[model samples]
Target: MMSFISRTVAACLCLVLLGCVAGQPERLAIDPRYDSVAPALQVYMERVRTGGERNAVLNWEEAGLAALELGDTDTARSAFDEALLRIESVFSDTEAAAKARSVWYAESIKDFKGEPYERAMAFFYRGLVDMWDGDYENARAMFKSGLQQDAFAEEQQNRSDFALHMFMIGWCCQMLGDYTAADEAYGQLREFRPDFATPSRDDNALVILETGGAPQKYAAGLEMSELRFRRGATQGVSRVDVRGLPAYPMEDIYWQASTRGGREVDRIVRGKAEFKVVQESVGKVMTQAGTAVMASGMRKDARKETKYVGAALTLIGISQMVMAANVDARVDARFWRNLPNRIHVVTTHVPCAATLPVVFRDGSGSVVQGGATTVRLLPAGNGFLGRATFLSSLLYGQ
Candidate 1:
């Protein structure tokens, strides 16, 4: 028969197992409205709002995308603001407990703290909204902020320079008549893609279309031997081929930066192999230490049933590990799905009534998806910009 202490220890172990399972964030349900968006977008947005506060960034991101689809620029801006605020809060917390919690439980809790690309997009999209509202001053400021993020990313070597953000910054600066800043922005872009073409000053109306979805996150696998845990990977839609009739082909830019400035600093690589190895090593030490404590307590019981106690505790530990693995493995998979995978800059003399027809295709050049929207080009001084008339249609695939 089990002694009081052994029975109590077993009960506690069971509770621990249960706690691991219970602590997992809830999976989000598909929002019906997501069906109305593009199929690729549907898959992306459908999963964004499901994780609750643990997924606050994703929630606001989805909200912003949905608002943009509906042409509600105000709501989209508000949602992006909230998303950025959540992201800022994560890095701004100086408390030891908060920091410890993040280190230990960030993945298991599903509290996504924004990837580099995602963070920059927050500023980029906000800038786009400002431009949509014809607020060039605020738009320029937002784009500059986004460029600063790119520079920071470059300095930290967290990610490659974001070509789209850089182009947008240059475009914004051009609109603001800051040709020097515009040249600087374009110059940086040229460093990435040397043969990239710039839109002529005489061109009117810039049509930017985001096709296909960003990479989806998925659980790679759990490695127990080396104490390595592979949590997330870029999955789902790989590459998209977009063609806008009567549009200029935009350049695809890619660049890398060094992490070591002058002296070497211990930097954290979030989702890479080295980072996962370190994370798992820490987790393994903690788990084993914890299991050892519980086992020791069980052995101290008067009952000679240490085998049974050990078995129970072992089961509990395994169960807890599995639960944590499952939870941690569940990736956020949320990103700015509405942003154009390809951008086309069309420069043509705008007639009183002109429409731009844009089409999206897969790698095989099959028209798997297409949008029906006719943008009216309005003359803005020397150049032309698309009126907000087609914003809803462009965004909603109408």
Candidate 2:
């Protein structure tokens, strides 16, 4: 028969497992049909509706990506708007208690708040939505907002400058016919990426290419031993690689400093290929430590009965191992999956009413067979905006 202390220890161990399970963040069910967009959207929307504010933010991000894939720009815009707003509300809290709780518990209980690049890309996508709607002014505003966010990130984290955002700013100015502003933006982009290519004055349309999904997270290479744990080692956690797209071409231009109020535009455009470690899996380490501590307590309590103590210790150890294996240490794999892995720009004049063929190729230079789309040029003022024949497939992939 078990002693009072052993019984209490076993009960407490069981409770610890239950508490961890209960505290886990809710997750949406995956759809079996990989190509079906509606079911995915439905699951995400349901999570948002029933999962409270934090869940709403995460699910809204998924919903926005799905809507973008489906060519429902309006829905995408609304979802992204709500997501950005909710993220701000949660992370912007300045209360002392909230800060303390966040430090201890925020990451393990909720969704990923996104890294600087991801957050800045949200604004870029919003700007694209506005551009598709012919709202150039708002599009420009969104791009500017993205730049501001990048600046904030640089100030707070000392992150590298985002050349992509700078290029977008120049592109927006070029579309707006503000040559002076466009030149200045392009000049800044050159400073970041010395080999970046600038668009020609004669080029009419911009083709943005997104390819491949972001890297998925998984648990691997865990080193958990009693000695290591005793030594305060928390090395059993998740890690991710720096995933980014390759760079492509642009044209060269020379601008006189005196022409644009002494604002010098650089003579070259350069390609940028940069990546960084976005999120770490410290939560897994914490979870592992917590489980170990509980198991240690149970073992200490069962010390009196040799045979029963071995059994009790074995049970505790097995339970914790199982729990750790089951814990989804995979960082929230949810991301704007449809966005291009890399963006390519080309400068060419499209004749009025011409159909511009856009082809996509992988890193090996072979064509993604079904990845070609045609854009019908519609003259807008002195330039052109394309009406993609298969816009959905072009933007999100088949």
Flag clash pairs in model 2. 195-269, 195-270, 195-271, 196-269, 196-270, 196-271, 197-269, 210-340, 211-340, 211-341
Where model 1 places Cα greater than 4 Å from the true spot, the runs are 1-50, 89-111, 152-160, 219-344, 347-354, 361-398
Worst 10 residues of 2 by lDDT: 267-276
Q: Compose the digit string of candidate 2's lDDT tens values, residues 136-206.
A: 67777777776665554424333335566677778778888888999999998898678866778766665
What tens digits encode model 1's per-residue C-alpha lDDT throughout 1-398?
56988999999999999997787556655445545654534544544555566666766676676666556666677768877777667443434324323423333343555455556667766776777666767776776666555554535543445666767777777777778888898898788657667756554455555443343333334321111212222122123322244443342211111221221111211333344555455556556665665576566563556555655655665655555453322233344434333344544445453555554444455444333445545443334455222123234321
Please report how far candidate 2 places residue 208 from its true position, in Å: 1.1
Per-candidate TM-score against the hidden true structure: 0.60, 0.57
Q: Candidate 2's error at 192, in angstroms?
A: 2.8
Report lDDT per candidate: 0.51, 0.49
Candidate 1 clash total? 9
Error of 1 at 257 (Å): 14
Estimate the TM-score for candidate 2.
0.57
